[model samples]
Target chain A: MIGELELILCDIGNTTFHFLIDDVEQKYFLNERLPDFNETIYYISVNDNATANLKHSNDDLVDLEQYVNFKTKYKGMGLDRKIACIGYDDAIIVDAGSAITVDIMKKAKHKGGFILPGLKSIKDLYPKISHKLQFDFNTKVNLDKIPLCTQDAISYAILQSIIEPIKKIRKKQQIIFTGGDGEFLSKYFENSIYKKDLIFENMKRIINANNCIA
Target chain B: MIGELELILCDIGNTTFHFLIDDVEQKYFLNERLPDFNETIYYISVNDNATANLKHSNDDLVDLEQYVNFKTKYKGMGLDRKIACIGYDDAIIVDAGSAITVDIMKKAKHKGGFILPGLKSIKDLYPKISHKLQFDFNTKVNLDKIPLCTQDAISYAILQSIIEPIKKIRKKQQIIFTGGDGEFLSKYFENSIYKKDLIFENMKRIINANNCIA
Candidate 1:
């Protein structure tokens, strides 16, 4: 708890914010708005939600820092994702939210990622407008067949988008899920770990590796 | 070869006509012109590329005889899907293509399905419309991440919509895959069978079921 942890991770995106104390710890709450539990170096995330594009209020941000007492590598990163990869090691982080952020981290460096819309947005577009059917997009359930309406179709489209690609990627690397839809997406994408507290977990991993004195 | 086969089954839709002379025989050819195929059953799909709705075509009514040959039960059904569910006892058919079609068959009958736009539609909608570098969708080969593009987003959404519902409904069932985009989707959905020749298989199934004899 005292002599452990290395980096602070902050991931922000559509729907929610996920922050953490260290690589092995759970993300508490970043100020109420930031989403992370702390802003310490032990955290991990693609984009710092607590400080991302459309984060909530500032009060939430302060609440998160009490745990570790640190700040991100950069404030207001061009993209929250940049914040996630700032100082991470070899690993792939997936931010599944309003948009899916796919990024890579190797040798303590972040590589640019692909930014696409999320399950909710894509499904809502077609089902609500064209198919003219009322199906619940957020409703989490297993369906054997397609819904006979517009909404369900939209919902199905968005989720499939994420699954299809991951299935195609041929890398046998460490995969972590973060962001609002992260937890939800975890249920579907196979063999992937869900990191609701990504920053905290990454921080702990880094700290353990480097023997941080935080 | 001719004597062993009892009948010939033909499927006409927006894109092509599937022919099945028997369980072991099948053929598929691109659709050329309307009121063209020699088959009695004409399944009409008024998609964007369909010319069936055009006032220019006068003698193209598939009518009752067509339905009789196609089984009045399958009339007005989604062409690709109807043929897909023909033989499965329990399964969901995902026709991933320019547009996505997720249809499920349960207990050897059409249990209906959901429809939504495909990945391409989502990508094409933006960028060209907004100079703000809007996120596009895609199904990249990143097994540990989601796509970040309009096309991939659409793809994910569709996949989720289909998987979520089917996963819940099947209780315990086999998921089926077909159509142009079937391969792309099957890889992600996993634990599913793909019928590259679903229409033809269906034609054979139907023709053989009725011992379709001239």
Candidate 2:
């Protein structure tokens, strides 16, 4: 078995590289200097540039995509998303980052999933539409009541657009929220679990199951 | 009462000028040469440059923002939205143009409303996120079931995000759909009416009510 001290898991997205080391989380931008660690890093990357850059470096890296055996019907699904769904028998996994991906797993089999623009994406979108629509989204706005002002209107729209479909697809399955914006979105659900170390935890599981470590 | 033949109504948005004359609708690009018409035109515009350009011309034009007297608490609400909500007493008025505006009216009193990025805005948004996400939105995708493919996933997200909120806010109040994408969105709801000339019809009603025409 791989000791906790020797295990390092990295999830590289389009803009950032997130690392899990000995129960501690560390994050760095894609363009930032790589951390020099003696341990072999088991990583799954969605960014091609970052993947190529890391492979060329001296850091002993093991690409974990080969070991993920989740049965999903979603073709061209992101590696990060598939990794997050590991060990779940039944769940609605929501990875809310630059893009919010919602996937349903039943009896350890991936049913299907959909994606929506994240909060930052929606926030950046309004200004391009019109100067009048250039307002900060009020995330605290009450969703039950329709908005009376522009700020709330925009806020309500963003929240409702994301939350409603999740509620529609949900049926007694516990929603597992992960990624950057996961906690914020999980607050809206009653039977949802916010797992900050979801991907890394599952990565560790995959590492143990496959006996990849020496 | 002003005869329909004598009244010329124009709803000017950011990109195009939509005119209703003698029950026939005509559209023109904002950059295109202005139509030379003999009749005095009564118009409501959300585009500042188009409004300024029209005002500078020799054609007789009347701005209709001053004539609307609906009671609403929504501050900085667009004149086009307010004009569309003119005739509806108890309904959810949806204007799905460049931006989708949803306003609720209860017994001639404007309760509240919200704004959402329209279909075109969402379509343009995907390619910017990632080239892999560059797929045309499938409007006919079944919103009742979660999507399995990327194309259906995107299409489901757009439709569900827009439609679900309208359904949630709806409680026997007839949903009134207007604007460019109004007809497309209205098909999802049972208790909804698609009014292609909703703004123009309300503009004409305001003219008749206020006796603006001499």
Best by DockQ: 2
Q: What count of clashes does model 2 give?
A: 0
Model 2 CAPRI rating: medium
- Writing each residue's lDDT as its tens digit, candidate 2 over A1-214 gives 6564567888888877888887678888878888678778899998889877766653698888898876777888988888888878899999998788999998888988898887788888887888889998787999988899999999998899899988888899999999779999999999998998888888888888988886
* Model 1 bad stretches (over 4 Å): A1-78, A84-98, A102-114, A118-121, A124-150, A156-214, B1-79, B109-119, B122-174, B187-192, B207-214
Q: For each candidate, how many residue pairs have backbone atoms clashing (under 3 Å)?
A: 85, 0
DockQ of 2: 0.79
lDDT by residue (tens digit), candidate 1, A1-214: 6434233444442334443333333433434433323333332233344354323422233222223332323222333455445445777778775556667565665543445556555655564333423456645533444444445444554555565445444266667788668887777655667867555444444445554543
Model 2 TM-score, 2 decimals: 0.94
TM-score of each model, in listed order: 0.46, 0.94
Candidate 1 scores a chain A TM-score of: 0.53
Model 2 C-alpha RMSD to native: 1.9
Model 2 chain B, TM?
Answer: 0.93
- Looking at model 2, residue A168 earns an lDDT score of 87
